[model samples]
Target: MFKEFKEFMMRGNVLDLAVGVVIGSAFTAIVTKVVEGLITPIVSLIVVLTTGKTS
Candidate 1:
C-alpha cells in the first residue's frame, strides 16, 4: 500500500494536476480583477444612464 501510494504521487498525472491547479488559481485572480476594474464600471455606467440618476 505504501509503495502504491508513492507511485501514485510520483506519476505525471499528479504533477500535471498540481500545475493546472496553480495556473487556474492565477487565471481566476486576473479574470476577477478585469471584471471588477473594467467591466463593472461600464455596466454601472449603463445602469445609471438608463435609470436617469444624476448622483
Candidate 2:
C-alpha cells in the first residue's frame, strides 16, 4: 500500500497538476498587476475626459 501510494504521488499526471497550479497562480498575479497599475489608470483617464468625472 505504501509503494502504491508513492507511485501515485510521483506519477506524471500528479506532477503536471502541481506545475500547472503554480504557473496559473503566477500568471494571475501578473495579469492582475498589469490591469490594476496600467489599464485601470488609462481607463480612468478616458472616463474623466468623456464624462468630466472619474468612475
Candidate 3:
C-alpha cells in the first residue's frame, strides 16, 4: 500500500496537477488585485462622471 501510494505521488500527472493548482491560485490573486485597484476605480469614476453623484 505504501509503495503504491509513493508510486502514485511520483507520477508526472499528479505533480503537474499540483503545480498547475499553485500557479492558478497565484494568478487568481494577482487578477483580483488588478480588478480591485485599477478596473474597479475606473468603473467607479465613469459612473460618477455620468451620474454626477458621489456616494
Candidate 4:
C-alpha cells in the first residue's frame, strides 16, 4: 500500500498537478492583494463621493 501510494505521488501528471495548484494559489494571492491595495480604494472613494456614505 505504501509503495503504491509512493508510486502514485511520483507520477508526472500528479506532480504537475500539484505544482500547478501551488502556482495558481500564489497567483491568486498576488491578484487579491492588487485588488485590495489599488482597486478597492478607488471604488470606495467613488462610492463615497457619489452617495455621501462610507462603506
What TM-score would each prediction reach against the true structure?
Answer: 0.75, 0.82, 0.85, 0.71
- Tens digits of per-residue lDDT for model 3 on 1-55? 9999999999999999999999999999999999999999999999999999877
Candidate 2 Cα deviation (angstroms), residue 17? 0.4
lDDT, candidate 2, 1-55, per-residue tens: 9999999989999999999999999999999999999999999999999999854
Q: Extract clashing residue pairs from model 3.
A: none
Kindly give the number of clashing pairs for every candidate: 0, 0, 0, 0
lDDT of 4 by residue, 1-55 (tens): 9999999999999999999999999999999999999999999999999999995
Candidate 4 ranges with C-alpha deviation above 4 Å: 1-7
Candidate 1 ranges beyond 4 A from true positions: 1-9
Looking at candidate 3, the ten consecutive residues that score lowest on lDDT are 46-55
Q: Over the full model, what C-alpha lDDT does candidate 2 score relative to the true structure?
A: 0.95
Report how far off residue 39 is in candidate 1 (Å). 0.6
Best by TM-score: 3
Q: Give the clashing residue pairs of candidate 4, or none.
A: none
Higher TM-score: candidate 1 or 2?
2
TM-score leaderboard ranking:
3, 2, 1, 4
**Candidate number with greatest lDDT:** 4
Q: What does each candidate score in C-alpha RMSD?
A: 2.6, 1.4, 1.3, 2.0
